[model samples]
Target: MTIFRLPTAPRSLQKDQPIKFILDSEAIDCLAHNIALVHPVFDVQAFRQLALTDIAALGFMDRSAHIAAALKATLPAKFADATEVLINTLTPPNAHTERLGLGVFFYLPHTRFVAEYGRDHKHNAGEDPFDAAMRAQYELTRRFTAEFSIRPFLMHDFERTLKQLMQWLDDPDPHVRRLCSEGTRSRLPWGARIPQLIKDPTPTLPILDALKSDPSLYVRRSVANHVGDIAKDHPELAFDLCDRWLSHADKELKWVIRHAVRHPARQGNATAIALRKAAGGR
Candidate 1:
């Protein structure tokens, strides 16, 4: 068993505080080993050859981009074929776990690769590329969270992707339920901004409404973050949601309302103030 140590951040880039674990050489090696286990034909040498140069100089996004490009070089030339091969090679998600780690962490780069490949490729005559990407993300999320990878599909096909997210609100897996809210967040951290969602978050209201009291704290936290993201750009809409959900709020629902209003409350927004007051200023 090989143990991989996370590389230290370079002094010059320490202030930005890059997440060192996700893009380190160890992460690449872990991914290579796992890919080799699942796909005997995987070109481990070729992948490392393309991935390790000047890796220490790159930030998180740059590292992800390099790994993704490396995957394109080493995997099948045909995008669909490569995606299917990866899907088949994926380790199953642990139904009992909550946090992502271990082999799961290694899979994140592959998930990003598949999502990017789907975005860049053309589907067969009757197939929808967005649907294929969504399916790949769904499978990947079982092993590791797909919160970041789902953004591109949401950006390219808002209505269709949103409809699928709405359906995911009731998914059996907490991870999927979390994705429903997290992926749609207007200002998801480390994710590309969705201008349409920032401008008007009305479409996401139904999903939030359904998830505010979700049994999974993991899912509910995402709902709070989703509403909080909306609050940044559309405070009125965020307030409206707080007003509606607060009227008959339970403990869990109250938590969501409080979290959603936190940014606004700090900024002296009237509705946020009222919601805080209604919660006995807790």
Candidate 2:
């Protein structure tokens, strides 16, 4: 595994005395392995929070993908310790879904990782870290690939994965269906910019079309974001998407459009400005 090290001190740490942070054995092992080459001093708790926050911040850059890959590689293969740590870290207030968003950011490269660790019928659902890992893995992996990676492959042999993801859109589980949209978002946080779709986003039309009216607000938000991404590139399309579905969209979808178009709107992008105006400041 590549060694990832951070600078011996961050700006904050360098200014203050070194604050000792203790980590449990599993987290310690994971951090040591992952950070061995990375160089930053990690206070166990701080590092974990950093990981979660970084995961949520994926849309900004490719940094989270590096963290996710390093995180998986560094963790002890045995789940006994890691599972407890991960579960304990879960707090509703923290927005576990944001951590899940990291999955989309790191999805394409982690395909192999997910196939190796994702749910297996053989594994029973329980305290098993493997199962939790699998569920978490799929939540991040499948969704991201379905949402983002789907477009890249459409022009070539990628259709297979795309079709498979579409099938997952109809999954019995709401999480899986949500993945179908969230995974494919063009402007998803911490993910790559979908230039092709950005220029002409017809590729994602079907996926967004399928998810536009999904029962889960979770799934629908992604669809809105996916369309909003396209809108940045082609505002007319975004306008059409919103105009066609305005009645069906809830507040979440509107929020996504506002966020995704913020930059373009600021840049005086006529399309986004028009959509912004049409939306009537809601």
Candidate 3:
């Protein structure tokens, strides 16, 4: 209920100072106020604004990870509607420059929140403001993390997350369905890549299988991208999926298959070439 004010600009100019820089200072303040009313504990505006500064400060002190862990422990849970808020709020593609810093402070933490709350205490029901705020934060965190750069980190948790997300493909919510694909994209640009999925795409097949027919463009785009990521290594497998799905005679499935197999087609791989021939391309 209380407004979480954005932090004052720093006295010294550092590399991280400009990471969260908004040309429209007043707009950032206004947005922060709005988020505060909906979920006060998610006072991330200051953190978002000062992300580079915090990390810079941490780096200078040789405590970046320590600071990150501390913030994770301290930051309040997000608002439930955070995803809706972010989807409707779009920044310019190149806005917010301290990419890695921004990725770590705002986006990475959100991924952890989703993995934690969305997977762990997801069903916990309560009217407590804190609980509501945490859930909201988790959702918003997830939506925001989608914009971060993900690298292939070999971890047991990646497998667990992929399995859980694959099941979410059946979720009725379009957003959750989209996350199922988007979260696992091999080359998700700014997202962490699931190495196992990239090296051996079998884990992602089920998620793609469930989402191939998804009506939401947002969800389908991710499904296409997930398959495309697979095609980077296993062109044959990607072509096989395209062959099977395209045979279904559904326009949407065709579209997804086309997008998914685009990379292989560009590479002139035999499977992709065959798919193109079968799809009536000369």
Candidate 4:
């Protein structure tokens, strides 16, 4: 196999210019190299053939989707089988980051591939495949945030998925805790909207409650964003939660409450305004 040298940076289209596409050839080269390292059986030639063809015409996300589709074609026939192969062969999170500044970029396509696979086959008889996809995503989160990938499961099986997310609140990994909140957001950017959450965020309150004073700033930030997302559709709920947390809140929890109410406060919500004022406009 001929080794493709990873470009140090994206090739500029002109002097002192940056490439518009995030998923450019440099990214693809890094991805192909890492995948080949992990899964020796991965069809590098086929993957490159599909990924590099019509390359200039595609944008960032389109390039990602194209690579995922190509992966489905080159990997196992069944989605479950292909997912299993990927799960067993994924490179460690730190390894990819050490080599490529955008380590998570390599896994984004895989995450999308699994999510697409689940969406297409979610209505299948047993829940086994969806369960497998969830487990794969959990592992993926250790390497890269799988916040977007987990949404399909939430949409497909809300009850079971929420139950699992609740359990993840106590996980040792802060990334897992963050995913619990981020994945369930009402309006996660670049992600599918959860209308049910937008209507009533009651189901997600328990998870947020557990994470309010989380040790990890990363988890706390997600909790804040999750609350902010709720505020957009349910200001009352957001304020109520903020009030509850703020009553005897520590500094960390206060930070979260402040962030959660920011959007509502900007929108001139009286309760949000009061809450912000009470927090000294922090």
Models 1 onward score TM values of 0.86, 0.48, 0.59, 0.85
Give the Å shift of residue 202 in candidate 2. Answer: 1.0
Worst 10 residues of 1 by lDDT: 2-11
Give the per-residue lDDT digits (tens) of candidate 4, residues 167-272.
Answer: 7889888778889999999899989998788888899999999998998888899999999988887777888888988889887888888888888788887888
At residue 157, give the lDDT of candidate 1.
Answer: 75
Q: Whole-model lDDT, candidate 2?
A: 0.48
| RMSD of candidates 1 onward, in order | 4.1, 11.0, 8.6, 4.1
Write the number of the candidate with greater lDDT, choosing between 2 and 4: 4
Q: Least accurate stretch of 10 residues (summed lDDT) in model 3?
A: 91-100
How do the candidates rank by TM-score, highest first? 1, 4, 3, 2
lDDT by residue (125-211, candidate 1, tens digit) is 334566667787888887777888888878877888888888788889988888888888888888888888888888988989898
For each candidate, the alpha-carbon lDDT, in order, equals: 0.77, 0.48, 0.52, 0.77
Candidate 3's TM-score: 0.59
By summed lDDT, the worst window of 10 consecutive residues in model 4 runs over: 94-103
**Could you tell me how far off, in angstroms, the CA of residue 53 lies in candidate 4 after the best superposition?**
2.2
User: Which candidate number has the best TM-score?
Assistant: 1
- lDDT tens digits by residue: candidate 2, 85-173: 33232222213333442212223333333333333323223343333443443444334433343333333323554565677767665
Stretches of candidate 4 off by over 4 Å are 1-20, 94-101, 119-127
